[model samples]
Target: MTNQQTLPLPMALNMTLGESLAKRRTGRAFRANALTDDELSTLLWACAGLTGDEGRRTVPSTLNLKAVSVWVLRDDGTWRYDPAKNQLTRSTTTDCRRASTTHQFDFVTKAPVTLAFVLDHDVANTIRESCFYVDAGTMGQSAYLAATALGLSGCIRASFDHKALGEAMALPDNLEPILMFTVGLPEGK
Candidate 1:
């Protein structure tokens, strides 16, 4: 049976958009500290969580397909964030951070949380591949602002072995990995 972790209500990130924009900067150096459930919830929500009852999102979906999904990877397991439920459904017992990064970026392995942006073809069959990437890119930008507002460090990467990661997460064929956003406490903090 798959275990589900209910995310706590997201903490309001206090920084303004301008402040967050000014503070936002990509950093790959992450301290080996796991994000608290609250932090992860807030970040995930910022990335693509639902905002209204009409099934809208923090980031826009091409033609409102809402096909994008965020997969959370940490030392404990791999999880898929269900925005409708605000919960994470565990997908595997093994950590798949290594598969989420390229050989050149060992720092990714040291980060405590990596969010895999994915596109579900089943939900977006009519959309082109470029649309999938644009949607994911917007979510990545949101994640960067959220991390900065939360006083965390993060970097978005597309250097991972997609095939390896898909297999590691045991993702269904319909789900395609688009990007990886890794976040954690800044190193030396």
Candidate 2:
């Protein structure tokens, strides 16, 4: 494990659920500028961060499997979000943002950060495979709303080369990539 980068406390996301839903849309373009730690923290917390003392997450887990793990890909490197500690642990020194997208959607590489959601099948036990996908979608919607509330833009996609991404991130055999949410400031912002 590498040194953990503690995230700044997220700003209060006061937007009503309806408002966020109304504002949310697929990000068509992105600026190259990086998101601040505050923005990244809020966006990530909304995706899968721990809530309350009992250890529930922001997004509901099917069968409470809590099988999805979010890995952040950036220019600097890849990092795994550790919700319990509210920090990011470095996963690899390789920059895998471009590899996280297919050639048709290569534009996504322009975004400063891409969040890859991987499902830990071992943690999921014998549940149906579809259940893990549901968990990923749940977190994706949360990320969309949170991005809208934070004035950031994002696009959730499952179009990447799964095998290549897994190798680039150095994921263990048990982890399966479910989706990737590319995020950043909108162009001309």
Candidate 3:
């Protein structure tokens, strides 16, 4: 475990569902600006944090099994998103952006933030693989909308080197990368 700073997160915005839905778009042009810590906290909370006392999350998980985990990569280092506590725990101090697939937008490496969604295969099981993907898709879309509502640009991609990422992040064999969402300010119109 690495040094971490636990900060309080703000309440969810009052944006209407239609507004969030209409604002949703896959933005590949990300401004080379870092996202504020608060903004990052809000985005992570909106994706999978606990929203109610019963431990209900912002995104629905099948059978109440929160089989997905979020790992964030930034210029500083890699950290794991702990929704239970609404904080980021440092995982590694290496920059692994170059490990991402080349055909992806070239600016990905320069983006301020990248979110990787990891699925717990052990929890999903062979019979629930499809469900896990569906659940992850829902969470990923929520992340996109949340980023949009926060006035940030983001793109959801699934073309990263999973084996390398898993090893670098020190994720258990049961955890597998499902998708990556690169987020930052929009570069230009």
Best-fitting candidate, scored by lDDT: 1
lDDT of 3 by residue, 1-189 (tens): 445757478457667778989988988887777888788888888778888898898899878878888788887777888888877888777765555444674778878788888899887776557787777788789888888788888888887788987877777898888788888898883
> What digit string (tens of lDDT, one per residue) describes model 2 on residues 3-30?
5799998779998989999999998599
Between candidates 1 and 3, the TM-score winner: 1
Off by over 4 Å in 1: none
lDDT of 1 by residue, 1-189 (tens): 558999998999999999999889999888998999999999999989999989899999899887888999999889999998999999898798888876845788899999999889898887688998999999999999999999999999998888888989999899878899999999988
TM-score order of candidates, top first: 1, 2, 3
lDDT of each: 0.90, 0.88, 0.79
Pairing residues by index, what is the TM-score of model 3?
A: 0.91
State the lDDT at 104 in candidate 2.
41
In angstroms, give how far residue 152 of model 1 lies from its true place. Answer: 0.4
Sliding window of 10 residues with minimal summed lDDT for model 3:
96-105
